[model samples]
Structures are given as structure tokens and as C-alpha cells.
Target: MDFKYVTQEERERLYNEVWDEPLKIVAQRYNMSDNGLRKHCKRLWIPLPSVGYWAKIKAGKKVFKPDLPKVRGELKRYVHSYAIKYRSDIDKYSDVELQSMKGLSLLTDGTIRYVNEICSNIEVKNQLRNPHNLIKQHKDELMYRKRRDKELQQASFNTDYYNITKSKYRENKPMIPIYVSEVNLNRAYRIINALLFAIEEMEGFANVMLDSGNDKGYFVIMKTTFYFIMMEEGKNKSKNNAEEHVPILVLSLSAGDEYYKCTNYSFKFKDKVDEPLEKQIGIIILEMLQTANKILIEEMLRDREYEREIKKKERQRRLEQMRKGELEEIKILQQAASDWNKAEEIRKFTNQMELKIGEIEDEEKRHKLSRWVLWAKDKADWIDPLIEKEDKLLGESEYIFEEIIETQ
Candidate 1:
């Protein structure tokens, strides 16, 4: 049968008809090669059911294969059913109550603990008061000092600092606490809690191995630090009615041989907070942090693998150069032996000719022989040139041969 003459449709029809038959039978009946038949079946999208599917089909039971549309409809129905059944429960839930949910509780508690610990720590407290709080409290004073310094074009480096301190003392600043409404605080907490739970869920699939024992996991610590900053802001704002609350988080992570540093996570609320709002801000921050960490880790791994490949290639190239040098050395030694052999052969030939000339007698014959002897002598001179040429070849060979020899 001329398989090439067959159209695609004909091939597909032939494939389907013999698809259920034994391979040998199909090949014979269709007048087609077994491989051709198989290829045709694959192209046609014919359901050549797996053994498991066939067994189930034979048993007269419907298989539980979920189609995309059916699965999507089922999901929609499930979500709708839940909405109908628990609409009131969901709507009535306070932010605090939502944050207390099993999944959210773990994250909220972790963040709260981290914040409290940081605030209570003497060193951290000092840093906060001297740097962070100072920056916030004396923002206007610092700005004024900066402007004055610029205007004066002063050479003194400490002029700006002196002006800021002077301005701060002149103001007689009252300690004003941060203010946050109860509603916003609850919201912020809920948002953060939700974010933490989402991150934990993702972590299950992320293949991140947390440090064992007392060793702090970089990501965990980073999250803790970020949460601490948010919590501190929340607490400070809770006391004063004048300042509006805002959710903000910052995190840093450092690791590896090169001490690669990264902003592990950060988030801030763009909207003004009329009340304490933590939940949404917290959740957004947590999600961003996890995403950044994943990207950083993947990038680091890819770079490390590329570096390893480069080192491997360098090692292979060195080995190849070493092998090449050894081969060239062997060739040079062989060439030298061959040249010496040729020189010895020429020397023996010259000696034999000399011996033959000595045995010849007769005046005319001797005279003619002398002329031949002079010609032979001229030829004998050629040996020196040949030997010189051989020496030159050896010298050139040695000059070209290079092998890396390690010095002690």
C-alpha cells in the first residue's frame, strides 16, 4: 500500500478503526505500518484510554474525572452556598474576632510578641528614642536647620546639627503621643493576621526549612522586625487623638557567603486612617514580604549555579592544556631519536666509501679515482649541513614545546 498517497483524513479513519485491535492485526488489515498507525492515533486526539480507565469502564462504573467547567461551577456553587449560610456571621465579625481565628491567631500572636520584645529591649528602645523617635519628633526643626545651613553656605560641618538642637530647645516641645481609633487598630490587626496566615499556607509549598533549635530563621526574624515596627506605631498612635494612624512595616534579611542583604518585606497604607486600621495593611505587607523572599532566594540559587558551571569549565580547560603539553613533549622526544638515527646512518656510509677508495691501485685509475674522491668529499660536506639542519629542527621543537611544571 502507498502510505504517502493517503490523505490525512484517510490515515485518521484507518487509525481509529484499528485502534482497538492487536498491533499485528491493525498493521495487516489497514495495509499500514504499526508505527504509522500509532503516530496517526496520537495526532487525532483519539482517547486511547489508560489501563486503569479501561478497567473502570469494564466494571460499569462512572469515573470521577472532573472537567474544568464542572469544577468551576462546583466552586461557584460552594462559595455561594457558604455566603448564603454564613453571611450574617461573616458580616457581624469584628476585626479583632477575625484576627483571632485559628489560622490568623498564630501570625497575630507572633507579631505581637515580636513587637513587645523589641520595645522592651533596652538597646532597641535606646535606638528607637535616639534615632527613630528623634527623627519623627524633630522633623520640622531638622528641616529648618537644613535650610539655614544651605543659605549660609557654612564650612562648619556641625552647623546644621547645632541649629537643630537650638531649635528643639527653643520650642519647649510637649510629649505628644500617637493617636489611633479603636476601629482602625482592629482593622490593621486583622489585615496583618490574614497576611501572616496566607504566608504560612504558602510556606507549606515553598520548601523553606526554618532553622532548628535556638537558631533564628531569617524570614521569621525579618517578619518579626517588620511587625514590631507596625505594632509600635499602632501603640504610639493609640494614645493621642491629634495624629492619624497609618500602618507601616519594614523588614531586612541578610545571609550567605557574600552576606547578601535584602529588603525582605515592606508595606504602607496609602489611605489616611481615621481609626486604627491594621488588618489590611498587615496582610498586604506579609504577602509582599514572602514574594520578595522567594524571588531573592531563587535569584541567589541561579547565580550560584552559574558560578559553579564557570569554575567547572575553568578546571576542564586547565586539564586539557596539561594533556596537550604532555602529547607535544612525547612528539619532540620521538623526533629527536629519529634525527639521531639518520645522522648515524650517514656517518657509516661516509666511512665505507673511504675504505673502498683506499683498496683501489693503478695510476690512471687512481687519478680518475682521485677526481671521484674529491666529488665524494664535496658530498661528504653535505652531512654537516644535514646534521646542522637536524639540530635546528630539535632546537625549534624544544622552543615550541611548553609544559606547566609546578615549582616546589
Candidate 2:
């Protein structure tokens, strides 16, 4: 019935008995105030199931949260892909044509999917058609030449030697009338094709110039570079009848002025190059200049991309290292926390033992000396000072008890 003097075991049994009751009922049964009951529950490390716990049980699943919506419409999707596919044709088309194509449904996602499907079909078709046959057909002439060369090698030694030496000399010869190798001729053809393509692409007024021999003859050389030559003839008059003369010949050269050095190739109108030809020349020169410029730009862009990739990798590595350091720091802090908790527990237990010692009555203390003896038996190093003080006090009390006994 005395709450203040209740033993630990009795308090534990009382707590277990009333734990399932309402707070008021439990407090009344224990003859304690509500606040005191609450304090006791807290000290015993008990948790009450609140509304939040009931809500979780009712829900039966985790709650869902949605992320914020993203902003759209910065760029036109798939425009780059379309541009790359039709770059050559697009470059030749007028602005009006480009606009017309831009308005088409190709920009839609459905159209893109259809286009991809078509491309895949085309690839499969080409694969099935054995497209390598077309390549072999194109190289047939080169193969024939190689076969002929091999046959010539198998012929008489003197004939073969003479042919090989003659071929070598022909290869080295400048402006030789002999038939040139097909490979060199092919290269020249490709160059001429490129020049013609440029001229046509520029609408015929290529900014190129040509030299003329006389008013009657215009000649252009296409040896090392392209040139255009023009010539006009003087009027021939009979019986006082005059007529304006037309240019006798208009010639273009894929080769330039570097080839012609003969005085016989004298020109009359070296400065009379067409304005269109001048423009073409300007374009060619501009394109040549831009070649180096393009290369420099591409190299710089590539270097920047590579540097960005390296920086990204380095950042990732640094982040991983930082995470590892943070984990290590957390582990160290957790260990320190555990060690502090254990030291606190030990201090609490020591204080409890000290309180128990203080609570003993004098006669009870003498009778319970055996209990203290047992508690301090193997822990002499820890309780030696306290035990010595207790023994001194007890000895004086015993002498007083003996004096009272004698007086009685």
C-alpha cells in the first residue's frame, strides 16, 4: 500500500496488470495522479499506438506522391535528322521549297515512326538484293586492267620488261600523247565531275577565268586547275558591209593558268573573264578558305566534347569518393554514440547501487553485511574505499551497541 517503499518487482507487476486499461482507470487503480502515471510509463520505455498507426493499418498500403510537371517546347524535334537525310537536295532547293517541306506532316511522331519503319524495310530489301554486285560491276574495268597486267607479266621476259619500263616512263611523263592509266583518268574524271557540278550548282556563272589565244580562239587549260578561255574574231567586210563579230570559241578548263607557259598560247582578253566566272572563282576560293576554317571548328568542338565527357567522369568519381567518406564518418559517429550510451548505462547502475546502500537501516545493515560481502567479493578493486569506510562506521556502532548491552 506504501507507493514510495514499493520494491522494483512489485512496481513491474502493477504496471503489467493495469497497462491495458484507460489512462484514468490505470492511474486511479495505482492511487497515483495522471501525470505520475504518464511519467512512469515514459521511464519504462512504453509506446502508445496513436491515430497515425491506426491510419497506416487502415490504408493497407504505402502512400503515393507525384513529382512536379516539366516545361516543354525548347526545340523542334527530329529537324536535325530530316536535314541530314536530305542535306544535298535541301541545299539546292529554294527557301520556298524548304518552307513547303517544313509544313509537311513529317514533324509528327507518327510520321517519324512510319519513316523509321520504311527505312528499316529499305535496308532489309537492299541486303536481300545483294548490293555488292553493283560494287563489283563498277570495279569490273579495274579488274580487267589488273588481269591484263598479270597476263603481260607472264609473257616473254624482254617484252614484259620493256612494257613495264614504258608504263613507268609514261606515268612520269608530262603531257604525253600516250594513253594514260585508267586510275589516273578516273581521278581526272572525278575532278572534272566535281568542277562541273560546282559550276552547274552555281547556275553556270562560275567565278572562273580563262585565257584566249586571239579574238578568233579562246582556250582554257584544265591540267592542274580549272580555267575558262574565250575568243572573238574580227569582222570580215566586203563591199562596205559591216557585221558584229561573235566569240569564235568559248572554252572552259578544269586546269588553271599554271599549265600554259608557251608564247604561242598568247591571249588577247586575259582580263575579259565573265562576271559570273569571277563570282565562281570567288566561291571556289571561299570554299577553299572555309575548308581549313571548318576543320579548325570541328577540332575545337570535338576537343570541347571530349573535355566535357572527362569532366563528367571526374565529377562522378569525386561524388563516389565523397559518399564513401561520408559513410565512414557516419560509421565513426555511430560507434562513438554507442560507446557513450554504454558509459551512461554504467553510471546509472552505479548510482542505483549507491542508493541501495544508503537506504539500509543500522540493524538491517549488520544482518545484510553478508549480502554486501558477496557483492564486493570479486569487485574489491572497484569497492575497496567504500567497504573500508563502511567497516569503520560499523565498528564504532558495534562498540556503542556493546556499551548499551553492558548498561542493560
Candidate 3:
């Protein structure tokens, strides 16, 4: 195993992630022993979280981050070696290793560039004034919920939200709702449309479609179906009359058909509505591509490691079978004790073939060698089979009594 190199940005991300959780939890993610990882951190001058940092946060108290130290010389990015743990059933999977993150990053970069080009050339419609009507409906539902805090009303709101806003890519192809004021929705729409176009230009991603209903849509990446969605929460009103609607745009990468979560993310933002449409959408696309890249990389790494383990197990199985064959040969030779030379020749040939089979790396070659080994085994088994004659010879024993009388 080789150490993975991390860039400055990745280092920062890892540092933040470690601080957000316990050391043991973070160590497990990188396949590192906890104490070993702690020592690595010390050697690298990477600061660990304070003893009670997580405790304070859990208790709803304010906590601050420790400043990263300045690098004195050439920076090191070497990570601890990652090992794939053995599992009895690992050989069942078709793919052994997942795609490499390096390759994925290249794809992501291409997608981002494509999206950038699309965004640059395309006209982003002013959709705020004619904003999706579902925005108003969501607001109405919110108002209804505020007046009557019942579960039924909440469920209705949730249903409306999903139906009108989220299921644009389903088989039924439902009607899309006009949600959010045109001002709030246009930026999201423009960015999403650009993303679709960029996905079209990129390889390994296809079946890209935007839904007619709402802002929910779906696409395929690396053979997996993923939903890209934009949802708006109703406006919030403060006593001072400050009003704003929070619109969330996300790509859900999950396992279930009905329930998916936006777990793999590159960037998260706050108060993005105030940003320029191009900047906002560009940033979103960048992060989205990054997230997709990471997912592909993880899948590839898993597949690679899995395949490696499967090969290892196969090698072990072959060796065990060979050992069993050798033991059986030994038993047969001991029984036909008088025909040692003939049996030895057969055993020697079998051993030679077995060694040749082990040395062959090409699978087809190994298979051929294995067939030859089987042939040798069959020849060895036919060495001596006159069990009745051998028994008669033992029973005859005529000279034994005469030798005893002469000795007397």
C-alpha cells in the first residue's frame, strides 16, 4: 500500500472533519489506528481538537477553532496507508476496485469547464416575476401550518412540497409548480439548466433530463441514477419586516428509490441569494462536479480493493487444493509401497506441473497448466492396483518357517 497525497485544500477539509468528530471516528474513516493517526498528526504539526471541544458543542456552548500552524519548510501531504479489511464475502462483487479519485477529478474538471462554457454562452431567463407558482403555494401552506400546528397540516405541506416541487423526473411526469418569486427562482433555474447542459457534454454521464413539473430532475453518472433538485422554503417574516425565502438546490446520492439524501457535498453556502447568478450557479456547479467526482472515486477504490482480495482468496484456494492433492498422492504411494520408483516418477511430474501452474500469471495459461496437473494426478492414481495379488503374496510366506527351524 502507498500513502495518498493530499493537497492543502484537502488537508484543511480533513482537519475540519477531524475536529467535528471524535478521534476514533475520524481515524476509522481513513482506515488508520487511532493512536497511530494521533502520532501522525503530531509529527505533521496538525492540531487536534481540544479535549472538550465536542462536549462543549454538544452542550450547546460556543467553541472556537484552533489556528493552523505556519509551515516552516516544504509541506508534507503524505497520508497514513489505507488498508482494505478482509471480508469472507468480498469475492462476490463483480468489480474489485473503485475508480481512482485522480481520474474522477479530471472528469469533474471537464464537467465544470463545460458548465462554465454553457453558462457563459446561454441566456439566463428572468424567471423571478413569473416565478414558479408553487412558491406561493408553499408560502400558503407555511401560513396554514403556522396558524394550526397539527401533524396533518404538516404532512400535507410535505406532500405538496414533494409532489409539486420534487418529482419532476419520475415516470408519471407530473405538472411542475411555479414556486418562489421569479427573482428567487431564476438564478437556481439558470444554474440547473447549465448543469444539465454540462452533464450532456461530459462522458460517463448520460440520460440527463429535466422535469416539466417543478425543479426536480434526474441524471445518470457512472451508471447510477441521481436526482438533482431545487426546493424553496416559504418566506420567513421578522418583526422588523425582513423577509426572505430560502431555496435549497441539491443532488441526492443515496441508495433508496424513495428516499435519497444530499450527503456527498463539496461546498455549502449561506445567504447565496444575494450573490450574482453566474457566480452562484458557477460555484454550485463546481461543488456539484466535485461531489460527483468524489462519489465515483470512492466507488472505484472499493472495487479495486475488492478485486485484489478476491484474487488473493483465489490464490489461497488453488494452493489448498494442491496441498490436498499432494497428501492424497502420499497416501496412495504408501499403500503401493513396493512400487516406489513408479509412484515417485508420477509424483515428480505432478509436482513439476503444480509449480508451473503457480508460476503462470496469465489466467488462460494457468488454466491449461491446471488441466495438465489433473492429467498427472490421473496417471499417478493408476500406478498399482493389484490388491488381491499383493494380499496372496503376503499370505504365501513359505520360507519363514524353514528359516526359523534352521536357526533352532
Candidate 4:
């Protein structure tokens, strides 16, 4: 496949040409995938237009370009090359190569079947749980403030066990306070236990622990942790079992840098409150497990990518050093070749003048020609040794790289 080495400035120009165009279309022009172009742009610290930028321009609204940040490392030549994948290539691929390109088997049929069986066995116990007066008061205050101030009016409810107060966090974000009822706490534990078993079955082990906050739980995997908080809806099924109640479970994930973002899910108890809570909890836990697995894989891929970049830079540095070592020899040979060509031309001209000396009739002209011939002969004689030295040096050029390698 052919490739073109693009300079940083040239890359920037190409990016600008497609700044307002869709990345997929631009990638097609460059014979690469959209994702490949995006990654290249990211690696080069090139700023790309954000979503809605072109839309804003079409709407006649003012739009601004994002400034590219100055990177602190030496820019390497980007070899732009790619080929669109075709079905024929897959057919032509060797079994080993095709196998290497395939994704890992994340879940087994047995694991899926087991998870489903466990979920089927979950029995939800009916309990008449009421919210504390403080919880009610907080909700009321939140509603009032939300209506009056046009700002988020979340009420604070911190206690010995559960908390619903605005807590300090890494990334500043608005969050709704969870309301965990006495009944839901019991249900939450059952859900947690089931998830632990499922994760253990799938991944061999689980490291889930209750957080210091008392109301939250955390599942740690290597350097990353997934934190979650569950809350109960105050409404309960009537004595006649005519009304249905759904409990809210807030799963707050610990995004690195101490940031926690919550994903909320509500489990409806339909008429199956007597049915074990396994199924409801199983579905949620399965999602969490899938998400956690994805996060872990992404982190691993990122670490490998970083290592590759470091190695690439190191290789470039070594190559640059080798080139610098040979640069002087290369310059000397170039200069020598130039002098040799000039010397040959001068010698030829002097020989032709020698012939002209016999033909000259005027004494003044012959005298001037003789002086010029003497000067040319002297210049050619002086350049002969230098030309020989350059020829020898060119022959020795092959060994220069070997010596550099040995020294390194």
C-alpha cells in the first residue's frame, strides 16, 4: 500500500478544509475510517469543530473555531494510509489472523442461563414502609424552591444510616438526593448479594463493600471503583393490592478523579411483590457487570496505547540521532562531488584552450589564454585529491551506520 508523509502544518490545513464537513466524508477523502481520522486529530492536539457548529453556521448564528493547543513534543511525520475492509479480504484471511481480529467471549451460555435461573428465583417480600417526616419536609422545600427561585431545590437529609444531602464531590454536578426506605434497604441488600454471586460466577471474584457514607455501596476493580446508591419510592400497594409501586435505585458510578455520576432505574413491583426480587435485581446487576467489564477493558486498552506511543517516540529519537551522526559525512560527499564535476569541466576547457594556443595569431590574446589555462590546470590539480577523498568517504558510508549501532 502507498502512504504519504504529512507535515503538522499540512495536516492542520487538511483539517481546516474539512472543519465544517462531517468527519466520515473527510475520512473518505483521505482513504481512512472516520475513527482513524478522529484519533489522528486527537494525537496531534488538533481542535475539531464540536457538535452543532455547522448547524449554527447554517442558521446564520455566529460560530467560532476551537483553538488547537500547542503540543510540547517533536512532531513525527504522519503516514496517511488506509484501505476499506472488504468481504473478500475476510475470505482470504488466514485462520490465525482472523482469530486474532475477533473479540473475546465475554459471557458463556451457561453463565447466561444461570443468571436467568437466579433472577427467576427472586421473591419480593411485601412490607408497609413509611418515609420519615424529615424526608417529606425536604421534598416539600425542594418543590417550593424549584418553583420560586428557578434553581435546583434539593433538600438535605443526613442521618446515622442514610444520607440525602449535597455532598462534596470531585466534579461539580447537580444530583437528586436518594430516599431509601426501611423496606427498600432490605430489598437492596438482597439485590446486592445476588449481584455479588453473579459477578463471582462470571469473573471469579467480587470486591463489593459498603461505603463510609452508609447509604452507598462501592464495587472496586483494580484502580477503578463503581459506587451506587439506592432509594425507595414512598408510595406503597394498598391493602386491596389494586395500586402498584415502583422503587427507584440510584447507581452512582465512581468516575476516576473522585467524581461520582448516578444512573437511576426504577423497578416496578407490578403484582409480583410476592415473587422473589431476584429478576429485578438480576437485570440491573447484569447491566452493572457489563458496564464495569467495558470500563476495565477500555482502561487496559488506553494503558497499552500509551505504552505504544512511548516506544514510538523512543524509536524516532534513536533514528534522529543516527541521522545526525551521518549528516557530516553526507555533506562532505556532496561538496566533493560538486568540486569533482567542476574540476573535470575546468580540465576539459584547459585542454581545448591548449589546442587554441596553436591557432592564436594575436600575441595579446594568446598571452591571456595561456594565463587562463594555467589557472584552470592548477584548480583541477588541487581538486583531484579532494575528489578521491570524497569517493573513499562515500565507499565508507556503508560502515557509518554499523559503527553507530555498536557505539549505541
Candidate 5:
């Protein structure tokens, strides 16, 4: 009923794991309860994590991990159970469960350290040369918007241009989501195309989501869906009589909702004084990808917990159904009545066979037919609970009514 790790190597591994994350986490990985794992560690002379160890690490503070003490004296001689079984435990499946638990030891600090590890071989170019398909589509849409705006601006006495412009912005083929001025529209597309290519280079897919009539940037990276948005941040400038915001690209990432522990992160980019946005595009994509990995890990944990709950509920439901099926008396009577009806149908069919057997002229065939009719009548009697007839192949008459057996 229990699994023990008296060996020094096993104890060391578990000790390192507990110190690496926390007792609660290593317990989950080993399919052991928190208290149970703690007790085993104590028995094996393994060191446990100190209080506030994980918290201090999360807060970016220095933390200490004490080395595990030697497992000597009584520990070397005696080995307690590695895992204790509860009342409903089935050890036959322990190997399968442990196999399922394999590779579950997730890195505790990985989520927070995601951005730091994302600085890999990714590049973002400044100029847009042979852009992505989406980039080309948006570029055409941008051109259309610009030309339409110009036509509407120059139409002083034309009411038709005003009417055409009213619905033209909304009905553009593959509507562009960027809200930058004419001066920066092309620049935005180049930056976006560069990021998309950079993401693709790093084994990720980047695309834009058309929500209703607006554009919402999203990408498929690490098998997780992340929503990103790009906006122009700048001071207003007067071009002719109309005022426009100067072009400065700002990018942010978000995914899921509040229920998913929704991740909302912004890249550390503000102005052109440091460098062009294109140069830093690779890091920005990495940051977004890191957050996606975080969300993926969180969702996996939630799903595992949810599956456990579902299994527990399903077991309880089966137990309740079993008890209910045993206690229900009317179902038994209904089953008996149903069997009686079937017996009568069989008898009726046998009667028809007996009457039809006279039409057969062949002697051997007629004899075989008559014997089958008699066997069919015997089967009908066997099926009738009141008659209590024993059948050869189906064994003896065990019950007057077996509703559950019939249903099963």
C-alpha cells in the first residue's frame, strides 16, 4: 500500500525536486498527497524546502537551498512504503498512472523567466521587401483608404464622393486594422511583416484576426493562441488644416479572459530615440511567445485538475446508479412482463412454423423442420420466468426477474 525510497539516490532525487520547486508541487508530480510526500521525505531523511523559498524567488529576491543530509543508521536499513493507497486504491494501474505522470515536473520559475530565454536567433528587418501575404493585402487596403481619403478631401462640390466615402472605409476588401496616419501606414505594415517573418523563422505562425469589422492581431505559437495589438503613439502635428498624430509604434499582447488567468503584457518600447521598432521586433515576439507558454502551462494544470474532478464525479455517479439499480423493484416486474411478451411472440412464431412444415414434401427436411419447432417452443418456455425452464447453453433458471442484467 506504500512506496518507499530508502536508497540514497532516490532520496537525493526527491530532495532535489522538493528544493527545486516546493513540496506541494513535487507531491503532485509523484502522484502523492502533500502530507503524504512530506511524511515519506521525513522517513527517508530527505531535506524539504524552506518556508517562503518559492515566494522569495518569485519576488526576485535571493533564496537559499540547504543540502540534503545523509540517509544513515535506521534509514539505510528500513524502507517504508513509497506510496500509501486509500480505500478505493487499485495498484494494478500504478505503473500506467506513473507513466502518465511522466514529464509532469514543470519548471516552477520558467513562466517568469520566459522573456529572458526568448532572446534567440530571431531577426526583424527595417525595410519591407517581399512582405508576407497578409502584409501585401493590408498594403493594398491602406492604398485604397489613402486614395479614397484624398478623393473625398478634394471633392469640394461633389456630394457623390461624400456618399461613396461613408461606406467605403467599412467595405474595403480585407479591411486593414492599423489606425496610423498616411505617413506611417507603410511603416506599420513593414514592421508587422518583419515581426511575422521573425515569428515564422522561430517556428511560430503570426496572423491577424478580423473581429467583426476591426482587426485584432493574433499568432499561433507554442500551440497557444495569443492576441496582440499594435497602436501608434505620438504627438499631434498639423498637415495642412487637418491635425494628425506622429507615427510611433507601440505593441502589446493579451490572451484568454479573466477565467484563464489572462496574460496581458506590453513590450518595453516607447520612442525612436533608442532604435527603430523593427530592430526590437524579435524580442517583442519572444516576449509574446513566452507569455503564451505561460498560459499553455497554466491551462494544462487547470485541465488536469478538471479531469480529476470529472473522474471523481463519474465514479460517484456510477456508485449511486449501482445502488439505485439494486433497490428498484418495479424495474424487475417490468423486465418479467417484457420477457413474458417475448415468450408469447416466440410461441406464436413456432405455431406458424408447425403449420408451415406440412407444406414441405421432402421427408428429411420436414423432420428437421419439426424438430426445430419443438426446440423453439422449448426456448420460449425457458424465457418465461413463471415456467422456470432450464436451458442447456444459457445455464439454469437463476432469477424470476433480472432487469439490470437485461439492461446491461
Candidate 6:
């Protein structure tokens, strides 16, 4: 299904095919559309059956078949594949026939060199030498758990075990997960040690933390942490329905990291059929570093964008603050203008009162009225913001937001 390799499907073969069965059936076999196949037959000089040819043949009537015509140039033969073929002579083919020719290519030299550079000097040895301290710790923990399991099993057989509480068989906690069959554990440890070494070479740390389910491997670099998982093909049901572990160890390595918001990029390396897991360590390292390089580049781009967004938002925040202060200042100016107008009105009223008080015949009453008018003028001055005359009860500080209450 991948490439439908229908090779040498030329004029004579195509002619026989269209005549033998429906174009749709032939198209399905060749992984092509019926209409596209019909056009293909036309260009290949292969004559097709008329619309009612099948019906006539079903009725036991004789049908006419045309002879295949000869094509001059590159239309003589056809093939279906990833690439197209043309004859050695290019000048014989016209523009229309030449259009069918296509070229295919492989990985560029630069990409090959990049992957090779990352994978350089990386390999899994026959045996691990002085395994990393963390690996030793995890190995010891596993041994302790195995012994505890055996103890728990023996205790289960004893009648007195029921008298004891469940806390007696508490399992030792695991560290730095290394999941594999006992047969493949040593190999897995060697591979992991190489992995840890690679991380150290990268000037990054190898860390383990429970992430999402049983996955515990993590690689920290450039202030970013990504999940990593190296697992052997376990006892799994095969296509034949037999459940058994693969005799040859096949390690599958996968890794992923968050990009923007909820987006994640996951990279996986498949096991090579002809080679063992130990032989492919360099290629695995290549894949890992290549994926990391791409992710780090993306992180750099996103960081720049993030910085731009922060600056944009900060500018917006400052503008909002400035607008708020401007509104408060405008309100203060408007309120001051209103109070000044009211103060001028009050002063004019007191002046008129003073003139009226002069007309009184009683000197004592006149003096008392004049004193009242002077007090009224002083009240107006206290109310005016520009004058800011302080009242004995209010002190020097402005209390514009509070109302004065007269105490009895």
C-alpha cells in the first residue's frame, strides 16, 4: 500500500487492462482515481471500451475493440512510483510529454553532518563500567524491593501473619525508573549510563521526577525541562496472538516538550531490524540532539515573541495609568472652578448685606449686622479652594472629600 509499485504499465499492458475489466477496478489496483486512469490510457495510446461495451458483452453480443496506437516519444511507456522516468533523448519529447518527468532527492549534506556530529563518539559498551552513583542507588532499591516481596510472600504462608498489621511489608520507594525484563536490565543500565553521560557532555543535568503517569525520566537544559522515556519491548501480544517478550532487546526512545501554551512536540526513534539496541546508541543520540536543537531554536523564537508581548502589555498598562491620573486632575480642576464661582457669589451677597446694614438707624444693631456680614465673608473664603482659609475646627489640611458636621 505504501508505493503500489505497478512497474512497466506500458501501452500494450494498459490496453489489455482497460479492455479486460472496468477502469475503476484497474484504478483501485494501481491506487489511482478512475478518471485519472482513463486519461492515462488516453496518453499511453491505449484504446478504451465504449460506455455500453460491458452491457453488450453481458448480453452475449459481439463488441468491437480497437488496436493500440503507437506513440512517438516519451509517451511510449508509463510507470507509477515516487519518481518519473524519461528516455535518454530529451529533444524527441514535446513540452506536454516532458511535463510528466519528476526528480526525487534525499537528505541534504548539511543535515547529515549535523546528525553525525551530535552522534559522534556515542556508543553502548559490552558492559557498564563503574555505573553512575544514581544508577547504583536505584539498583540497590530494586534489590531491597525484591527481598521484601519474597519476605512478604513467606509471611503470607504463616498463620501468625494475619495477627500483624499491613505495615510490616511496606515496599521500598523506587528511584530513577529503569523498566525492563530482568534479562535486559544490565543492557538497559548501560544504555542509561551512556544517556546520563551524554547529558553531562551537553552541560545539562539528568533528572527524574514523576510526570503524568509512570514516566519518570527528564532532561533539563537551557532552563527548560522535557520528558524522556527509554523502554524495551515488553511481553506484548503479537500479531499471531502469542504473548511473549521479544528475545532480542528492542529499545524505543521517545521525548517531548511543551512549545506554546498547550502544544507539544514528540519525537520517537524506531528500532533497527538488522541491528541490536546496543549498536544504535549513536543514532539515538543523534536523534535526541537534533530534536533538542530544533526545540531550543523554537524556544528562542517564542522567547523573543514573549518579550515583545510583555513590552506591548507594559506600554498599554502605563498608558492606562496616565489616562486615569489625567481624568482625576481634570475632575479636580472642574470642581475647583465650580467652588470659585460659588465663593464669588457669596462675597457679592455679603457686600450687598453690608450696604443694607448701613441703612439701619440703631447703631448697636448696625454694628451687630456688620459683624455678621464679616463672618459671612470669612465663611466664603474658607469654602474657596484658591484662598484655602483654615477653619479653627478643620486645621490646615484640606478635607475636600469629607462633609463638615456641626457638633451640638
lDDT of candidate 1 over 1-408, digit per residue (tens): 344343333444454554345555677686778677666444433334344664676799876442112112223222211111111243354544443443223233444454334223312121122232222433444355456655445434578766664554343232111123444443333333343333333231111211332112222322232222223232234235648553433222332223344334444443334522332434443344444434434444556667889999999999998888777766665665565555466557656766776787766776776677565444433333233222332332222123122210
* Candidate 2 TM-score to native: 0.25
For every model shown, what is its TM-score relative to the native structure?
0.31, 0.25, 0.38, 0.35, 0.47, 0.54
Model 6 alpha-carbon drift over 4 Å, by segment: 1-118, 159-170, 173-176, 207-215, 221-229, 234-246, 252-262, 294-317, 388-408
Candidate 4 local Cα displacement, residue 38, angstroms: 53
Better of 3 and 5 by lDDT: 5
Candidate 3: lDDT over CA atoms?
A: 0.50
Error of 2 at 152 (Å): 3.9
CA deviation > 4 Å runs, candidate 1: 1-56, 59-193, 204-277, 281-294, 297-312, 315-323, 326-334, 341-408
State each model's CA lDDT, in order: 0.41, 0.37, 0.50, 0.51, 0.64, 0.62
Backbone clash numbers for all candidates listed = 21, 18, 25, 8, 8, 0
By TM-score, rank the candidates, best first: 6, 5, 3, 4, 1, 2
Please write out the lDDT profile of model 3 over residues 1-408, one tens digit for every residue: 122454344556667767878889988988989897787667556799878888898899998888766433334335311111112343343442323223234333343455557545554455534333343443454455344444444456577754554333223222222244556554555544554444433322323233563334345544445554343334333434467434444333332233333234423332334443444544544455555555644555555777889999999999998888777666654545655456577778788879877987899989988887786665554443421221222342223234334434
lDDT of 5 by residue, 290-344 (tens): 5555565556666677888999999999999988876665667777788888989
Error of 4 at 220 (Å): 5.5
lDDT of 4 by residue, 1-408 (tens): 122455434655766856768788888988999888888777666677888878897899998877655323333333221110112234354434443442222334444465556555554334313422323333454455445433223332325212323232122222223456655555554444555444433322233232452334344432235554433444445546667555544433443432222333223331244543344555555555455444544544555667889999999999998888679556655765776677788899889989979798999999998998997686575665342222332342223334345545
- Model 5 scores a TM of 0.47
Task: Supply candidate 6's per-residue lDDT for 200.
Answer: 50
Is 2 or 3 the stronger prediction by lDDT?
3
State the lDDT of candidate 6 residue by residue for 1-408, as single tens digits. 222223333445767888999989989988989998887766555688989999998999999998765433344234331112223354454444443433211223443453355457777778889787668877887787787777667777766783363366553453676667787788778877887675554434666654453537676643345565555554334445566434444444444453364335565443445665666667665555555545544554566668889999999999998889778767776776788788899999999998888899999999999888888888788777777467897665333443222110
> How well does candidate 2 score on lDDT at residue 210?
18
